[model samples]
Target: MPDRNSAAHRAMAAAVARMPDPVSYQETALLETDLVAAFGTCRAVAVSSGTAAITTALAACGIGEGHEVLLPAVTVVMTVAAVAACGARPVFVDSAADGRGMDLNDLAAKTGPATRAVVAVHLAGRTDGIHDLAAYTRATGLRLIEDACQAQGTTSGGRQAGTIGDMGCFSLKDGKLLACGEGGYLLTDNTDLAARAAAYRTHWQSDAPDAPAGTHLGVNFRLAEPLAALARHHLTRFPEALAQRREQAAALHRAVDGTPGLEPITAAAGEEPNGYAALWRLTLPDPRAFAARLAQAGVPNSTGTHRLTAAHLHPACSRFASGDLPHARVTVDALLAVPFTEHDTDEAIHRRALTIRREAVRWTR
Candidate 1:
C-alpha cells in the first residue's frame, strides 16, 4: 500500500478536484500518453481492469465464438475468464521443464484449426520464453497477446515485454507494481488494433467518418479519472521502486544460496525479471510443510497463488478441459513464491531470508 500522504494520493485528490464533468477522459488520456512513451508503443488504451484489457484486445483482434486461444496452464484464472468473456475456448498449454514458462512443444501440439491467438504469460515477472513463443506464433500466423501484468519493469532482448507481442496487457491492481487500486492498459504498435481497442473500451464510440455508431459490440470499460491520475503518479516512481525490489531480491538470493532443498529460479539469458516475487523450486519432499513453516515465521508465502491447478480445472472453465496438463500440476506443487513489495524494508527482507534458510535446514533434516 502507498502512503496516504504520498504524491500518488495528492495526484488523485487533484484529479478529483479538477474534474468538470462525471464522465471525463482528461486524466485517462494523459495516463495513456505516459504509457505509450514509457513502453515505446504506438498507442495505449486504459481500461477498468486487467481482465478488461485482455477482453478488449481480443475483441479488437476480431476473435469470438468458435475461436480457440492458447494460454499457459500455469496462470491466474482471470486469463481464462477473459477468453471466455470473448466467447472463445481456452486451450491450456503445458509448462516448460523448469515450470517457469510455456512448453513450446506442447503449444505446438495444441495449436489446431480453431486456434486464432495465443496469450503468453510472463509469470512471476520473468520474460524467459516469450521471444520463442512470439516466433512460433508468427510462424503459425497466430496473433500473440502478452499477459505482462506481473512484469511492469521487465524486458527481454532489449525490448519491453508488452511491445514484443501483437498486443500486451498490464494490471494496476492493489498488489501490482503500478497499482492504482484497480486499473489496466493495453499496448500495441498496430494502428488498426489500437484504434479498435480505443473504440471498444468506450462503447465503440468512434470519431471516424466511415465507422457507424456501435460499429462493433463493446461495453463501458473506461478507467476512472482518479485511478488514472494515481497510476500516472506511480509510473514516475517505477524506476526507483524496481531498483529497490531488485536489491531486495538479490539479498534474498544471497541469504538462501547454500540452504539445503531450496533453489532459486532465475531468468534465462537476455531476459530481465521485474522482481515481483522471489521464486524457488522446493526440492523438499513436502512443499506444503515448508510453506506453512514460512507463514508461521511471519514470512507469508505461496505455493502457486491462484495457479495451483490448471485453468481448465476451474469450475467456470471445466467445459474447456480437453486433456491433463501434468507438468503444470507438478510444477505448482513443487514451487514456492515469496513476494518482496515496495513496502518491505531491507531488515524485513533479511529477516524473511533468515527464516527461509532456517526452515529449509529443518525441513531437509
Candidate 2:
C-alpha cells in the first residue's frame, strides 16, 4: 500500500480539489503536455485503457481489414484483441530464446505482402532489438507500433520505447509504474496520425463546433480527469522510483550470479532498461517444481504467472497463429517473475533473492 502522506498522495488530493471537470480541465491538459515533454513525442493523447490506446494506434495508423500486424506470440491477449478490433489479422511471431525480445529471424521469415505493421512489446520494461527492428521496419516500409504498457520509462539507443515506433501505447493500470488505477495514453511523432488518434479519443467529434461532421469514424476512449491527476503525480516520482528499482534489480542480479540454476534476464547490448519487475530464467529441468518449492518456502514465485502464456495458445488468437513457435514456447516455460516493488527495502530484496537461490540450489540438487 502507498503511504497516505507521500508526494503522490498530496498531488492526488490537489487533483481531487480541482476536479468535477476531468475532460476540459487543467490537469488533463497538463498531463498531456507533461507526457509529450517526457517522452519527446510530438503529441500525446490520454485514453480510457491500454487496450484502447493500442486500438487507437492501429486505427490512427490506418490499420484495417485485409492488413496483417505481426506481434510476439508470447504477449497479453489484449494486444491480439486490439488487432482484431481493427479488423486486421494478427500474425504471431515467435519470441527470442532469451525472452527479452521477439525472435528477429522469425519476424523476418514471417513477413509477407499483407504485413502492414509490427507491434513490439517491451516485456517487463526490458528492451528488445529495437535498432534491428527499426531497420527492418524501415527497409520494408512497415509501420511499427510499440506496446510499452509495462515499460513506462524504458529506453534504448538513446531513445524512449514508445517514441521509437510510429506509435507507442502505455498502460496506467493498478500495478503499472504510473498507476492511475485505470487509464492509458499514446505517444507519436507523426502530426497527422496524432490528429487521427485525438479525434478517435473523443468519438471523432469535430474540433470546431461549426465544422461539418466528424472527419473520421471513432470511439469514446478519453481518459478521465481524476486518473490523469494520479498519473501526473506518479509521473513526477518516476525518476526516483526507476532509480530505486534499478538498484534493487542489480541486487537481485548479484544474488543469483553464482547460483547453479538461476540467472537474471537481460536486455540487448547498449539498451538501458527501466526496471519494471525482477525476472529470472531457470536452468533447472523442472521449473514448475522450483516455483512450487519457492512458494512452499514462503517466497512466492511463478512461471507463466505475470505474463508467460503464449497468445497463440488462446482461442481468441489461435486463428492468426500458424507454423511452429519453438522459441516462444521455450521462453514462456523457462522464465519466472520474482515479486518486486519500488517501496521494498534493501533487506527485503536481499532476503527474497536468498530464498530464491537457496530453494533453487536445493531443488536442482
Candidate 3:
C-alpha cells in the first residue's frame, strides 16, 4: 500500500481533483506508457484488475469454450477463475519437485488435444524454471501466458519474466510490488494480441470510424484515472523499492543460513527474484506449526496464502476440477513465507530475522 504521505497519494489526489469522471482518461494512458517503458515491452494494456487482465489476455489469444488451459496447481484461485471466465477448461499442473514452479514433466503428461495454452505463474516473484517452461510450451505449440502479478522486477534467463511468454499479465493491486490499490496490465509483443486486448478491455469498442464490427465479446475493464496515477507514481520508485526488498531478503537468508531443518528457497540459476516474499522450505514435520509459532513471536508468516489451495477444491472451479495434485499439496504443506514491505527498515528486517532464527532453533529442538 502507498503511504498516505507519499507522492503516490498526492498523485491520486491530483487525479481525483482534476477529473470528475476518471474512467480511462489521460492519466491511464500515461501509466500504460510508463509500464511499457519500465518493462521494455512493445505494448501494454491497462485494465481494471489482475483477474480481468488474465481473462482479457486469454480471450485475446483465442482461448474459449472447450479449450483446455494448463496452469499450475499452486496458484491463487483467481488464475483458475480466469480460465473459467473464458468458458475454457482449467487443467491443473503439479508443482516441481522443489515446489518452486510447474513441473514440466507433469505438464507434458497432462497436455492433450484440447490444450490451447499454458499459464506460467511466477509464484512469489520467483521466475525459476520459467525459461524451460516457455521452451516446452513453444515446442508443444501451446500459447504461453505468464501470470506475473507478483513478479514486477523479476528476471529469468536474461529476459523479464512477463516478456518471455506470448502474453504476460501483472497486478497493480495493493500488496504487490507495483501497487495502485486495484489495477493490472497485459504485455505482449504481438501487435494483434495487443490490439485485441485493447478492444476487449473496453467492450470491443474501437476508435476507428470504418473499423469492422467486433466479433469478440468484452466487458468494462478500464483502469480508473486515479488508480493509474497512483501506479505511475509508484512505478517511478519501483527500482529503489526492489533493491530494498532484496537487501531485506538477503539479511533473512543469512540469518537462517546454518539453521537445521530450515532452508531459504532462493532463486534457481539464471533467475533473479524480486523478493516479494521471503520463502523457505521447512524440513520440520509441521511447517504450519512453525509459521504459527513465528506469528506468535511477532513475525507474520504463512504456509502460503489462503488462496494457495488446490484449484479443484474450490467450488467456483468445479467445472474442470479433478483429484488432488500430490506435488502441489506437498509443496504447499512444506513451504513457509515471511512477509515484507518496501518501508521495512534494515533494523526492522534484522529483528525479524533474529526472531525467525530463534524460532527455528527452538522448533527444531
Once fitted onto the true fold, the runs of candidate 1 whose alpha carbons sit more than 4 angstroms away are 1-24, 207-211, 304-307
Computed on alpha carbons, the lDDT of every model, listed in order, comes to 0.83, 0.79, 0.81
Clashes of each: 0, 0, 0
Give the worst 10-residue stretch by lDDT in candidate 2: 206-215
- Global lDDT of model 3: 0.81
Instruction: Give a tens-digit lDDT track for model 1, residues 306-337.
Output: 33556656676788888888888777767777
Expressed as tens digits, the lDDT of each residue in 279-364 for candidate 3 is: 88888868767777777777866542343455666566666767778888878777777767767777888898888788878887
Q: Highest lDDT: which candidate?
A: 1
Each candidate's TM vs. the true structure?
A: 0.89, 0.86, 0.87
Candidate 2 Cα outliers beyond 4 Å, as residue runs:
1-24, 97-100, 207-215, 292-304
